[model samples]
Target: MRCDNGPELISAALGEWCEVQVIVLHWIQLGKPTQNAYVERFNGSFRRKVLNAYLFATLRQVRHLLTE
Candidate 1:
């Protein structure tokens, strides 16, 4: 999977899980958002479809809506 240099995605826990699953997690260079185009596109789609279409007062509510 290709992703940005976010702390959560670069954490040891996620690294361990990827190792266990034999998956390679590649991070794009800092300040280079275009390198992670797929994630950016998905995020844009998600924002348009879910975020912009709702008004959630809490993080939990957002998470719940996403899971749905």
Candidate 2:
């Protein structure tokens, strides 16, 4: 249940059911948005491109996809 200021990733029901701790990363304190540029790019790429394009049927598949 971790996100980067996105409501879509803030799934309360899923978090509660899985008992996961949510963590968010912000770049303001880093002086500039580019300070955490890699994470910023990863978030958009993961959310928009990869996540939308992939559909996993099981937790093992999901885990394998992520781990690899």
Candidate 3:
């Protein structure tokens, strides 16, 4: 997984979980958003199209919409 040095991603808990799962994390350098441009673009689109367009009351509703 390629990700920025965000607190959540850098947490010890997550690191341990990844270690157990055998997933290698690739960290992008600070101040370099271009390295993760694809995910950034997708996040922007998801926020605009789905998140901003809806008022979800539950995880089930969000999952239902996402599946469609």
Q: Rate the local accuracy (lDDT) of all candidates.
A: 0.89, 0.60, 0.92
Each candidate: RMSD = 3.1, 6.1, 1.2
How would the candidate models be sorted by lDDT, starting from the highest?
3, 1, 2
Query: RMSD of candidate 1 to the true fold?
Result: 3.1
For model 1, how does the per-residue alpha-carbon lDDT over 21-54 read when each residue is reduced to its tens digit? 9999888899999998877899999999998999
Q: Rank the candidates by TM-score, best first.
A: 3, 1, 2
Give the per-residue lDDT digits (tens) of candidate 2, residues 19-51: 554533332443354655677788778988767
Off by more than 4 A, model 3? none
Better by TM-score, candidate 2 or 1: 1
lDDT head-to-head 2 vs 3, winner: 3
State model 3's lDDT. Answer: 0.92
Superpose all Cα atoms of candidate 2 onto the true structure and report the RMSD in Å to 1 decimal.
6.1
Alpha carbon lDDT at 30, candidate 1:
98
- Residue 2: error of model 2 in Å? 13
Distance (Å) between predicted and true CA of 27, model 1? 1.1
Model 1 pairs whose backbones collide: none
Tens-place lDDT per residue, model 3, 1-68, is 89889787889998899999999999999999899999879988999999999999999999999899
In model 2, the Cα lDDT at residue 23 comes to 38
Best-fitting candidate, scored by TM-score: 3
Clash total of candidate 2? 0
**Model 1 CA lDDT for position 18:** 92
